[model samples]
Target: MADQLLLKVRTDFVERVTKPVISGLLDDLLDQKVLQLDEVDEVQDRYTVRADKARCLIDTVRLKGTKASQIFIDSLKKRDGTLAEQLGLVAQQGPPGDQLPPPEPSVGIQGQQQWIQQCSLSEYQRIRDKEGDQLPHKKDPLHPRTAESCLSLSSQIYPIHLPRETRTRRALIICNIEFEHLSWRKGAEADVGGMTELLEGLGYVVDIHCNLTSQGMAVVMKDFADRKEHCTSDSTFLVFMSHGVRAGLCGIESGDETTDILSLDTIYETFNNKNCRALLGKPKVVIIQSCRGGKVGSVLMSDSKDPAVPAPIATDSTPAGLEDDAMFEVHLESDFATLHSSTPDTASWRHPKKGSVFIQRLIEQFRNHACNSDLQEIFRKIQYSFGQFPRQLPSQERSTMLRKFYLFPGH
Candidate 1:
């Protein structure tokens, strides 16, 4: 009956709910064991818009059955008596008889957005535009990419969570273009600007650091891992752009010129489950736009005329829980996907004014397809785009994700 009551008032709830109330109710419901940690994260991180968050919160609570719904209603009554009254919710225990002051007139808290970082997605500019290239195409506005009912992957039904809109959607970018001793990564500013723009469009507050040394890179990653924002983010993207050696990224330093280097292993270890508790069980995406070695990327080219199509991805089937059970032990490190600019022991190409070919393709692929494709799929498209260009090939490695990650661009 309580669930029905909530279901009946759903539209009104969505229309009238405010951020403070949502935040407060989430804490209370979570403390009451009516909602799990991952579930709370699901509501807060998945959607960016206030109304969307409200819709999800109520639906999640109501589905838990009568007790949960009643708790939610009671919590609502205390937090915003006027709206609660409008929804016909009376504290089961009538307002105290003079023992407590009357329910104060609705704090009339004029509803306002909780997270207010304004973002304007930037344009993709390609230098020396390939005369016949289709990329860096004309810009198109990003529309919201809604999620399907369910997502099946690897014989598991890991629901590709919906991207309704949430309070915290953050991204980190470290671009090393200028160096004290090394030549400037000439067009790197283009990559920096382009990446910031595209990610902001995808609802991320891009935290950028320019010209960090190897040690500095480690510090930055450590700080980012500890940020409070991750508590409310369903997924995150960490990007590094700079010169590099086979061992790892060549932090604002060139080979043999400086001792600075941020090993690839350190980056992963810094964000692993033990180190980054805040991001545990969430999608942690990494993009590296630096050369791995001095050698050319192409090796054995296929002489056969047959086209190279990617292997077919598996379909979804089994039904899984809303989140990993709170009690069950999960893998120490999972749900991480890293894309490298060039394969190991190879060099990646870039134009002086355009930036790394990898970053440019990133801007193109994500801008064009992110609204409809999951992150993994978009990465695949990027890899394919580099197929004909024999100089370099982006490689996807160290991926441990269990679900399809949809960005839902505009929402």
Candidate 2:
């Protein structure tokens, strides 16, 4: 049931929003001797922080191999003054340990309180806002939660679809939101809703979701791996919208340390044939809206500056790729097709209303072209529209990766 899905989403929310604080607090306390070895051992003995810890590590993660150091710090700090002194000596002689000294006694105590409040407050508010006070655990959207699912940090990206008919292929739209909660992101909302409208009209069974976690996102793609099970036809479309750092998508959860975003590859690779079913050998289309680089080195427009409205550009339709044999070569046939509004080389684009520039352009074209031509033609048309969409002063760039996919007539 959809409510069960919502319950799963709630689990994700806890993992995303609250688990980090608990995990970090555990780390900070254990390192600072605030939490004794026995306490940690007891917690580990009962519940060793699996999902919660994994989520924290996934977000706070750095290069690699640092987690072990963190755990060592926790265990070492759990020991008495003698061990700390010995560890201090080891650190002085070798590498400094990764854990930060526990905050000043007063500060650590107060900070712990603050962390608990901050960690739980916003999520509770969000659940209350969505589910209401009386009916908190409304599992199905059809029936509101009787009590907001009390689970911490759990949330979902709702992707809805209607069963397909004979003429149309199945389509999936994935929208990722890096910033605000999924409910609050107007840009993501409109774009996903718009895609649903356009694709449904185009004779495709469209599946859509907004603001998914890395794991959740991967699961969505994996669901698409089976072409026969999910879709009646061979062709399909997939979309991704999110706040992204270069090469990655932001998970709703915070990092164990740095809070840097996770890579899109974390989710995208799920659709790879070795992993998924329905998506194998199908035309997989992906659209992304996120910054690709850090070095734009330019100031953003001031409050008084008039926004440059996006104007549609005019261009004749061209073939998907340039090479002659490339027409429908489907170069890595099982691979996916991607069209990113911002090059992995640039930062991000703007959308005060309907969503990211890439999604905005996608909706515009899908609305205009989905019904008339094949998915290949629709993509090319959308590509042209995006190339024409206006950007802020340091105009954002756009590009696509076909990865050996062909959406229309085969050569």
Q: Top TM-score: which candidate number?
A: 1
For each predicted model, how many residue pairs clash, with residues at least 3 apart or on different chains?
Answer: 5, 45
Relative to the true structure, how large is the alpha-carbon lDDT of every model?
0.67, 0.43
Over the stretch 243-356, how does candidate 2's per-residue lDDT look in tens digits?
Answer: 555546655542334343555555455555555555555555665655544333224311110122122223345566556254333432344556665543455554445455
RMSD of 2: 20.3
* Per-residue lDDT of candidate 1, residues 1-411 (tens digit): 565466557657877899999999999999989999998996788655676578669867865656888788877877888998887765446533222223322111121121112212331111112211322234445633223312222222122234435447668888776565655666776676677656655666677666667887898799899999788777789999887666677665544446576778788788888899988878899999876655332332211111222223243443588454533323656788999988866677767766778888988888677655667889999999998887778999988886666554444
- Off by more than 4 A, model 1: 1-165, 253-257, 295-330
- Candidate 1: give its CA RMSD in angstroms: 20.5
Listed in order, each prediction's TM-score against the native is 0.54, 0.43
Global lDDT of model 2? 0.43
Best by lDDT: 1
Cα error, candidate 2, residue 104 (Å): 63
For candidate 2, which ten residues in a row score worst on lDDT? 301-310
